[model samples]
Target: MEKTVCELFAGVGGFRCGLNSIKDKDFSLLSETWKTVWFNQWEPGKKNQWAYDCYVKHFGTSLDLNGDDTTNVDISIVDKNAIPNHNLLVGGFPCQDYSVARSLNGEKGIEGKKGVLWWSIWDILKIKKPPFVLLENVDRLLLSPSKQRGRDFGIILSCFYNEDYFVEWRVVNAAEYGEVQRRRRTFIFAYKKNTNFAKSLNLENNNSLISEVLEKKSFFAKCFPIEKLDVFSIRKTTISGDLADISDNFSFDFANSGIMFEGSVYTAKTYPVITKSRTIGEILESKRVAEKYFISNDKLYFTNSDSTHSDETKTELSSEAKKTWQYIKGAKRKYRTASNGHKYIYSEGAIPMVDEWDKPARTMLTSEGSFNRSTHIVRDLLNNKIRILTPKETERIQGFPDDWTATGMPEKFRYFCMGNALVVSLVSRMEKILDKIFSEE
Candidate 1:
């Protein structure tokens, strides 16, 4: 059976491309592996919805593609029955406040300041009741809303539990599994009560359920194999049924990996056994790059006229430029004042200024351009010059086709789209395992 999929928050088809493009034994493309029946992509408060434009341009506009504001457009009002029954529902929901980048605020989590897109997903699950569900979000979701840890994730698990779904999740760093960049995102795979995987969760071995689910039967366990968990390290807890209670008092003790079924969450630490990977240099496109893409020597410095030496204008020292780069990468202690008139010292550890060609590139940020500290800097090995990665290279790092998000829009949005995207290879790996599991059932 050809597995059908409904992609929500489909940012230019990362999940679509990954699932639809299966590889043969010799690495040839297989198109009929999975079909994307329905998809939705919309950016709130943007007059020029480039993300939707790019998606429609690439995948072609159809009735199945909902380009409207998902939050505002009620699915029930607009054709609840219009959504085709799909075998799987997949999405990389917006990770706004769920990210660690946001400072601590007591009033945050599932019902935070931003839109509650999770409720929209929950609504869809209730309507369609897909046998399988796959979702992606920032790893910070494991312990969010600094005041109440794990409340956000707990609400999500409880939603699934209410639907009789058995869920397993792991924080996967794509580079650890041989992907091009080091993008860490939490992936949750759930099986409804009717599925064999879910049925197995009810087996009569109370002591071994967690170990069996994580080490033997879970989808992620099969795709990204992990080291055995120490028996003592395994933690088990019964989550409260009331989300309000969990929201106020939930502890953030979830390990890097875990499973939640019924009302209990079983978790433990696990390590990845990375076998192979591609480095930054392997995805470079020097021959196809334009001269403007490289940072010019003139732009790297400034000139200062010295009265002491009228004949010579002191050129901005390369050391000065290097110092700026060092500051961005190095950690330092500094006294600061908060907006509330409180004073304190702020500090953070530094990262490598330049990404290494021998290793995978660092995770990209929405601001992937010159002067952005989170942007990747590469020293052109051929010319010994430094420059930010091109939009095409950024796409390549996320395993998207070059110019995949290039829909005649400005280049900056391309970076923003890729920054919010999930690694295509990661989705493909999970889809392959999912196909096998579903086929057997």
Candidate 2:
């Protein structure tokens, strides 16, 4: 079996970087076991296209590989038939409302702008029928759109089922699996039923199949070990309908881990086999960060209340900025008015003013540098100052190389890329299992 890959929604090559174990700043060397034949990355409504530029800087454009037009175009407009055939398809597609509707010609069609990207993936599956697929998304995909709890995921399972594939998924928190960040994402691993590994599984009995796959047999189970399966916690359901039908009415309490085969879904909550995770202090920069990252003394101190009026006013401006951040992070209970002219009380709990050093950092958000509750602020032991995480530190949090996104992009976007990236080590851990599966053929 060939180990060619087609990377979709390739955000700064996170999937590619992980698969190839690219620790260096550039892609001068790649893994001999797996090769990426094609990739696509495009950010709509953005002129600069920083992510695509960063990707091209590391890995050359599609035109450089196979004479294809470009890898930096909107995937929705690209023809699926143009994609090269490959043994593996991998990506971290955006999470969106995956509702479906019947077209005017009575064919099932995806509804909404972002939801179409899922169909773009389905289109490739229908056309190329890759032997394997590995994908990542926010953990919320298991239960999306409050009105229809699990409809979105159910539709995805149905699509794979129709294509004669078996899927095993797990919601893994990187921190739980010995990574620095506490980011949680859903990982979907699917293989064609006719594949060598799939045939080896005991698929005749759904009960045994679920237990074996979730506990011992599946690649996900092998890489990220789970606690012993308890039969009572398993939930079984049959997904038997078209995409539109499933979208219109399909809801199940899909657990954090599960398998889907031949339309039969067996899902159950499974705990990770915990390991010691690296702490925020361990990944922080050894050298002192730029002065701009540090909170100035004016911002850190409160203006003296007994000072002269002009002096107090001058100092208050900078001091108020720090106070606002404290107030945002602190508990709040206040009265407010709604848009409909209804008076109400809005309450919120406080979060830590400074992130803990000994523990793995909280999930890094796209707004890491901003003065918000979600941003990570820590006491820089080297400089003896409070500061936001630099771009390199953010990269380390997500298991990327020191300056993976520092290739000519703006500093702020570097944080956004890491916030959107997967833990590279997570994919690196699965490489051996994937290699074994491929070699079996």
Candidate 3:
């Protein structure tokens, strides 16, 4: 029998896709979907990929109630008896409470709903007892204020330590791995005591171990425009830099030190820093900018002390129009673009930064964070307006193949899908170490 593998919290199967190259030959059974699912009649949970038509079409519909034969099985699911014995388990667990980008709002550890998923993964590991386990998550998981963040991670370590598995972790930036994206995630690897890692586990041996894999080079060295950029343009973007150095008051254990990474050989690009506290919705142009509007009283009044539309009828109309504008603006949210090219403007809180090449991107989400469907974007050499990256662009930034997901899915669906994907170059490197571990020993 081939080595069995399983994926949890599969998220459009990014882990599955990466493992495909391995499982195709060395591995046999693959398990995904959810676990403890006793009956199909219990209904699919939100986390189950089965609700997605695209998932079924790609991975084949799951019929197994849990793991045993109902029909086919979702890679995300498991039933005690149906579960397959696997040599490896890999996945990026969900992270919301542990995410620094979100408001802590009284949450501290794995106690929150999203945070609790870690326990579930741990449970499965306890049951299946795979020889190795790989996990991915936002780097922030290392230190969260509730002390809960640190506690949870510590618990994970203790769990593995007691199970006779050795654990190793490294924070990897996608940019460093080869993709032009500034995405960063933490990789957690665990190996059973008997697994002979040999030189593969030797962090210094990455070069020697990956020579063959990197040789088949077929990626871009640098992203367009970013590779050949004028620093003057960026210099011009500064609104105001303080002359006086501000003293920082807060002290934290893990000081923020980013090591932007880029890939070697093909498919290379500079990682544009993810713009923080901004959004991609600001690229929209404003249409109405009048300093004043009309007002009315009593039976009806209109205009201001200096306006010509002070006439009673004009006043009434202006008042009505202003009110109408408010309603329309509220309904339209940020902007209203008509097919004829007319864009209706609405009131905004502050000018939010839109994602553009000329500018860095907004912060990335763990999985279902904001702007899940849009990428941070800025202008280019041309002055024309642009939209955030579609799913296809996201795939490239994540080091996924151009045809990363099967074609024909709606752009919105794909965008969200790609946003949840991992940076392949980083994870791929981690996987290479595993490959060598098994091959050598």
Candidate 4:
């Protein structure tokens, strides 16, 4: 049976591409097995809709429905039945404060402003009940909102528990597993209660749930292998209560990795298996790249106004960009005063002037093309010039094909999509696991 998928928060079809890829011998890209039935992509407060345009350009738009906005809680503008039923649901929803408080009616629970999008997903899940769900988020989601450390994640678990789903999660770093970037993200995989995988969670020793999840036979532990876990610290703990109470007092010590089954969550620390890594240089494009992409010495300034340079007003790098490499890559301590009456010391470290080709590149941010401090600068070994990474290079770092975002869209938007996307190779590995489980069924 061909598995159908619906992608929420789909950015340039990264999940779709991985799930569908079917390569021939010699590992060249070929075809796909999985099918995407419907997908939703909307950027709030934007008129251009470049992301959506690029997505539609790459994968033809779905005409099965008139409205597909998940945030429309009312569902009046859109018809629920318009969505095709599928076996899988996948997405990398935005990270936000996931606070759940008692409803004003005092009879129901509601999520925080940004967290309301979750309810949109739940709305579809209740109706469609896809057998499998795959989601991705930042590593910090494990411990969010300093005041209430694990409250957000606790609420997420409770929602799945209420729906009778068993979930396994891991914080995976692409570089650790031989990918091109050092991006770390938390991935969540869930199985409905009646499925074979969920049924197997009915273990003889619930106290050793964490160990069971880390076992060789477990799905995640197999795909992304991990070292032994300290079972005592993270086995068979329950976070139970009305959503409101859990919000007020959730555990502050949520583990980095875990599984939730039958209302109980088992969590522990897990490390990745060391593997070969690809560096920034390996993914660079030279001959095809235009000369304008190269950075000249004069273009490195932070300000266009005629003001004396200070730590606050200087460029990301100095006029002598190459000479400032050390200052850009070293740590410094400085005393400063705030705009108000407060006085304090502000100190921070610097990133490399030129990204190291021997190691994986750092995390790509939305401001990829801008002259921001976090932006990557690489030395063109061929021409002996320094320049920022082009959008195409950014795409390669995330395991996407060259010009994947090129559809008459602006260069900045292309970089933005790659910044928000996951490494496609990571999803490709998960696709194999999904196939194995489905075949067993």
Off by over 4 Å in 2: 30-32, 64-66, 107-115, 297-323
Q: What's each prediction's TM-score?
A: 0.84, 0.92, 0.52, 0.87
lDDT digits (tens) for residues 1-441 of candidate 2? 888999998988888878878787844754445788889998989999998899888887774234566688888878788788899999998888888777766443545345368888988899999999999999999998778899889989988998999998999999998999888999999999999888877665467557877899888899999888886788899887487789888999899999887888899999989988999999988886888998765544344423222222223234364465455565555566899999886667767767878989998888888877798888897965788889999988887888989889999999888877888989988887888889897
State which candidate has the highest lDDT.
2
Q: What residue runs in model 4 are displaced by over 4 Å at the alpha carbon?
A: 22-30, 65-81, 106-115, 201-205, 233-236, 299-335
Worst-scoring 10-residue span by lDDT in model 1: 305-314
lDDT of candidate 4 over 1-441, digit per residue (tens): 358888888878789877866222122223457878788877766777787777777666764454454421233234556777888999897677767776787555564554356766666777788889999999888888778888888878877777777878888899988998999998988889898876665643455655865655567887888776666766456867467677887765677677777776777777777788899889887665578777766554333323222353233444564233344344444456788968675656655556877778999988886766677888775776778888888989988878888878888888888999998999998888889888866
Model 4 TM-score relative to the real fold: 0.87
Kindly indicate the candidate among 2 and 4 with the higher lDDT. 2
Q: State the lDDT of candidate 3 residue by residue for 1-441, as single tens digits.
A: 133456666555566556543222122334431221221211135443432444344464344324345423333344534655567777787554422222355363223234355655665677777777778887776555354334334445445654656554545555433346656676676666556641233322233322221222101111111223222221101011111110011112321111101111111112333223222222222342122211123211122322222222222244454432122222122355688999765433322333454332433543321332222433322334333444444555555555445546555556567666776555554555455454555
Instruction: Please give, for residues 1-441, the per-residue lDDT of candidate 1 as tens digits.
Output: 358888888877788778765222122234456766777777766778777787777665445334433322333244544566788999998654421112255455234333667766777788788989999998988877667777778877877887878788999989999998888899999888788767755643364766876876778999898887666677887776555566556666677898877777888888898857799988776654566666654443333311111111223234454335444455545566899999886666767766878999888877786566688877765675677788888888988877777678888888888887889888878878888877866
Number of clashes in every candidate structure? 0, 0, 39, 2
Ranking by lDDT: 2, 4, 1, 3
